[model samples]
Target: MYWFLLLMAGVFESAFAIGLKLSDGFSKPVPSLLTAIAIALSMLMMSLAMRGIPVATAYAVWVGIGVAGSLTLSYLFLKEPINSMQLISVALILFGVLGLKVTSTG
Candidate 1:
């Protein structure tokens, strides 16, 4: 349950990131409001997951997911360029996140 919640939080983190970009520095009303909602939900989920997961592992995994998700979304929706190096980096982060989950007792 905690892991699931953590994953959700990470997804929401990416959503908020995209929302911020679409919000245009908060000039757009709908996107800005949605972004704020996403931020709140992401934090809430992360905080809930922390009750069961170790803080260090949870935080790292959350960040790793956020990075990977945001990068992917940017490449797909925003047509942002993705180089080989960036792909490799994202793969490494995913591997590290997997390693943490496998090693974690909780």
Candidate 2:
């Protein structure tokens, strides 16, 4: 259940990030509302996950997932640059997140 919640939180983190960009600096009302909702839901899910997950671990994973997802979305949808260096960096972040979970027995 905790892992499930954390994954959901990560997805919402991605959603909110895309929403933020779509909001166009919050000048668009619909996207702004979506951004608010996505951020709220992400936080809620993270809080729920925290009941069973350590703070540092969960946070690192959450941010890692967010950074990867958001950057990928930007590349695909927004036509942003996705150079090899950036891709490698995001992959490293994912590996680090997994490493944190795998290395810790606590």
**Clash totals for all candidate models:** 0, 0
**lDDT of each candidate versus the true structure:** 0.97, 0.90
Q: On residues 1-106, what C-alpha lDDT tens digit does candidate 2 reach at each position?
A: 8777887899899989999889999999999999999999999999998888899988998899899999988888989988899999999999998898787543
Against the correct fold, how does model 2 do in TM-score? 0.93
Per-residue lDDT value at 33 in model 1: 99
lDDT: worst 10-residue window of model 1 = 97-106
Q: After superposition, which runs of candidate 2 have C-alpha atoms over 4 Å from their true positions?
A: none
Q: How high is the lDDT of residue 39 in model 2?
A: 97
Per-residue lDDT of model 1, residues 26-66, tens digit only: 99999999999999999999999999999999999999999
Q: What TM-score, computed on C-alpha atoms, does each candidate reach?
A: 0.98, 0.93
